[model samples]
Target: MGSTGDSGNGKAGWWCRRSSSPSSSSTASSSTPSRTFETRDPRTGDVLAHIAEADKADVDIAVKAAREAFEHGKWPRMSGYERSRVMNKLADLVEQHADELAALDGADAGKLLTLGKIIDMPAAAQMLRYYAGAADKIHGESLRVAGKYQGYTLKEPIGVVGVIIPWNFPTMMFFLKVSPALAAGCTVVVKPAEQTPLSALYYAHLAKLAGVPDGVINVVPGFGPTAGAALSSHMDVDSIAFTGSAEIGRTIMESAARSNLKNVSLELGGKSPMIVFDDADVDMAVSLSTLAVFFNKGEICVAGSRVYVQEGIYDEFVKKAVEAAKNWKVGDPFDAATNMGPQVDKVQFERVLKYIEIGKNEGATLLTGGKPTGDKGYYIEPTIFVDVKEDMTIAQEEIFGPVMSLMKFKTVEEAIEKANCTKYGLAAGIVTKNLNIANMVSRSVRAGTVWVNCYFAFDPDAPFGGFKMSGFGRDQGMVAIDKYLQVKSVITAVPDSPWY
Candidate 1:
């Protein structure tokens, strides 16, 4: 309802100095009226700050700066060890300002402060450190050839990379894309989601402080249709690493094909299923399954929204799940005890509500929480639906909210069949003590990553991506860095060899 403070100072301390150059110190002219948008606190529907919207012109400048850095700046020319030192310094800066960074996401994105501090911010720093450790490990391989020739492969940076991150998990996604790109000696122009740009701008400031060249990393905060479009379609950009919806991923691919055919890596949407076998610990299964769908207010791309339990535990699991949903805390993100926060904004809030109505109309029984909570803010109660047919809208579409669909499966075959029914194949969780069942389901499922007894267990070492419509290209691990790199083969006939 009211302004929190200036974007540069006061309660919300996110720096917002806009400029066309790569310098973080440069500022836009506020005196002249230009296109702007209000970023709000989802917890209160209050304006956090008025952010300068970056259009196609702004995107062009950022891309040009990245290109300049990649071509002539010290960053790309620096040895891998030298680059690693700088990136590790940036990671140190992230840890030093961890709480402040956590708070920025809390106020700007309705992310729970506890989760931000413990999980989001720390993982961001860890990502930087993980990639930093791998910076020097990027190497070419000596190849054996059929002819008498010396042959090897060269692993080189893929030039300027344009990264577009989504609002959900803003800080984590920022580092997820940018860290690996930087480690590969690639200059990056990142356009953070307009809804949550505070942490990204802060990271840009940290990069400069950590001895990175000015143009090596640039942050342009703007809307998807404009700045995002420009970056995806830019001819000079060598690659585009994006994390968002499948629909938008298609648009980016189309743009890439129409442009310079830049390399594109996407981590898109999912309606992931968590299978609970009859032998599972019911209490543990309930706890993990509840967290699977409700964590991050069910905004996660790998959310286990569609859960299938064996018929032996179907009624018991349903009863416990309803109780779990009812007990899930939906309140202010700043509250230490609050596990779930509000929807990112009114649009997301309304979208979740619309799906709840759709579920009710589709004849699914609402066991608990089908309505909004609190007088203000975009809070929705944890919703659970039963009798969800496989073809039902709630079972089929990805409703990115705190909504769960509990379906019963009589056998492992049915569970696997139902799980693979969706077009999405991002991630899934299987809960079973039987090794055979776990192995069968894990192998049979079409998703990219499968958890045996856990949900949302992610590490820097594990490669993450999607298989069908969920989009392609791994996000973490050594493979992720390869996406931002190009392989060049070098061969020459041995001077003294018979072939020569």
Candidate 2:
């Protein structure tokens, strides 16, 4: 293990110590020593795993294999039921190895092992099963023809796909993309975020174990600009599904346009707001609001970062919110009692600290934790800032860390106005017992998913995506498979009566 100032977040020289086989997925070729890199633990700033770094040439290999699998292999050619058989087997394998996968996810991404083991890992396998059961159920419809032609629509796979996932939820993101694409009969080449690649690589190894055909799924772990750009611009890839910052989403659009003009679906940035009305239960609101922003150390895309409280309960809410923030245990990811962990890396750590500084300079009240807590790793205490203006940098920008911004409102109309002020429309949460307010606010929010009295309620059966600059296209549910499928209209002359 070596650290020389450069981390994987755009710098160089830091080296990770943990060893892994590139052959976990395939017979990876030997690369120049200068090209490989490593992933470090966020809690201790210690090297965790050494991954075979990929560049344009390696992306070419993965894409070529993926294209071949999509074109000639049994995967893309198989019936939905046949494909489901393999997917179900893969899910079983996931269940069998849940503990190992959870540990890898915990070590690599700084995700709580409890979260990985209990929620993310099982949800991942369940995701595979959800899509697997729906595999044979994917179908199109028939159109009534008034004239002389019999017409129907056929939904078919769009061929090879490129999936670029973020580091926050490595194992879940992998299955979220791979499951639906496979169910839709599309082979995929996945490029997991460089910060956390161990679990994704492990998944490819499991795919091999579950009897998924070679070339059906390939994983290349490298920097976004290198392997990710190569995969995005590849001419053979039919579509690309990406989840990350909005800026990168636009760049991916340009890359797709420059290449084959591939189909692109993106789930981008969010400044999701959680609004609590005076009529709401103060304790329930406080509990959910803390979990909304601080869960996963606030690394979630749909995290309710903006907290709005009604003026009637503003002081009480702040007092309770600060108390709730302190209850979050920030420590090692592997610790059984830890509820919060360090930032994913040094870059994110610096970014969160900078935001906290900006919040202070902008006149917001730093009611609770607003600084780093540890000496060895990238750890920060759960922070809360009250009296935050909507235009403040911390409130507007997507701070992908455990930082909360508090705002006050007088009326429901004002709350809705403030919540919808941001460009991001990923998700929003409202805590109120009033049925009319809940129903009205749920419909009025610009975000894709709205929780009336809950926060972060997600399921495989629900369609999730962004609405504005947060980007578009759905991730879960049967609609997710639609992004990877093309509908073709077929018409035939009725009884050969029309000659035209």
lDDT of prediction 2? 0.86
Reference-based lDDT, each prediction:
0.87, 0.86
Residue pairs whose backbone atoms clash in candidate 1:
1-46
TM-score to true structure, per model: 0.94, 0.94
Q: Could you tell me which 10 consecutive residues in candidate 1 have the lowest summed lDDT?
A: 1-10
| CA shift of 384, model 1, Å | 0.3
What RMSD does model 2 have? 5.4
- List ranges where model 2 is wrong by over 4 Å: 1-17, 20-34, 496-500
Give the backbone clash total of model 2: 0
Alpha-carbon deviation at 454 in model 1, angstroms: 0.7
